[model samples]
Target: MNHSSLDSTMMLTSFGSFRPLNYFFFSLTLLVYLLSIFSNVFLMLIIYFESSLHKPMYIFLFNLALNGLIGSSTVWPAIMENLLSDTQKMSFLACLVQIYWGYFYLSSAYTTLSVMAYDRYVSICKPLQYHSIMTPGKVKTLLTAANIVPLFSIAILVYLTSRLVLCKYTIQNLFCDLVTILNLSCVKSLLVNLCGACMLASLVVFPCTIVLLSYALILTVSLKASKGAQKKALSTCSPHLITFINFGVAILFFAVYNRYSSFLPAEVYILITIDVFMIPPLLNPIIYGIQTQEIRKCFVKTVRKNEIFFRICELTVFRKSTSEHNS
Candidate 1:
């Protein structure tokens, strides 16, 4: 491979034969992408204007929304082009960039999720010390660590994977995922697969375990507290816990199922991916804002104001048309 094709691993293997429903799946992917973008942006706005949302939980949430936006941008743009075009070709550098960015975005989000777990852990495990431990300055440090750790990890993974060059490029997934891309290597891949597996276990699997354990302890502690305090704790944690489930289950799909089996079809791959990338961003705002009375009222008022402005604009354009008549 030349310097230009630095790490080309596009091996063309039919995962079997294509089906007509591939188009159907791709169309659904298109819809999911559009909705993901719209919903994430709305969530971002709700956080932006709401002074009451300045807590660390909401800060982590804003980070997730931003990361989800970046992740969708990396996957969805190529996907849309591939679906519409006859030639579905991505350049070597371009593919590498996608792999890099996808890793970066996901790592940042995963780190944030882990930090969130510890935040809850402290709140429940050490209630009075929670304020001292989960301070804003500390939260910033956690966010920074979450973002930086992933960058270093991705740099190493990319460097390692680049050692193998493909005879030609063939990938089964809709976009350039690391798993599908790694399997594209023509060279022997046992060691690479092992290393990647370790990385997934460390990054994805371990963090999820932390979250699960944290929440378990949190629930246990809350149960020991007074009934009112227990109810309030449950209310606060429930939305985060549910969003975490949506995200965690999706990560599990990528970490476990996608690694073990190549037996599933492309549509199944797409759906699994959408579970992680598309659904959480769409669901988070609805989960949090709908349950929070103040946010729900603000959203309704915003909608009414927009509707009124739109009707006034239409009336202005359609007004008696005195100028047109004179002309």
Candidate 2:
């Protein structure tokens, strides 16, 4: 806990009380991580390999799945490792990396959802112009913007945080985040706080505004159209709406928890922290997979195709064995 050595290593004190349940936590975390990886990867591959799913809508869903995978991979493994380790110590450099990607994961998520809202808006509100507006090149541009903006923006925050003089070497949470690291600073920089507030507005408020506007337009258009059109719009936007609400709630709770951690119980704090990373990644694929007809159909077809292939292999093996015995 030497202040001088804070530059080399920092301890995660959150794991101290839960040391006795390390095995249980490790098992549960591993399960969730595995499930998250499998679901996201499966959804991504389905969208990628299926030629029919190459439209703007499916493409956006694919990116969302990819984002979930990246976000989950960024933190879950570290949590799993720390749970099982005797020393819940992370190196200074590593903590910064986690904070960087952690912010990237969250910001990119909102931005991607914003982009998706725009896609749905174009598709439902301007069906004739959907393809023209969301051209492959444009899609690439939007995706690039979704990722790069968050990356550079977060890099600045992390850089500012890196220059701070720390009064403490221990973080109270399971994984590193900007707020936790900033709390440990010996003296808070006004500029850093300003940048963080601006970041919150840019990363959260701006994207949310875009989502609202896009959906509002879609809603207006849907109301004026035929029942069939209304149904189509509802089906298309429902999954995205559900996803946005789920993520929005998690972010809202996270913001509140970080600001008011002093007033919250330890168990509430832990649950909020874990839920931020856990629920979205774990449920996104499920929501889309279950709600989208094309995805469900493709998944069933895939399972049947694999089953048939395996059955054919077994039959061939049986025939070969029978011929060899007779000979």
Clashing pairs in 2: none
Candidate 1 lDDT over residue span 16-56, tens digit each? 34556658867877887878888788878877887887777
- For model 1, what is the alpha-carbon lDDT of residue 108? 70
List, residue by residue over 195-247, the lDDT tens digit for candidate 2.
99999899889999999999999999999999999998898889999999999
* Residue pairs with clashing backbones, model 1: 10-168, 10-169, 10-170, 11-169, 11-170
Provide the lowest-lDDT 10-residue window in model 1.
7-16
What TM-score goes with each of the models?
0.82, 0.95
lDDT of 2 at 36: 92
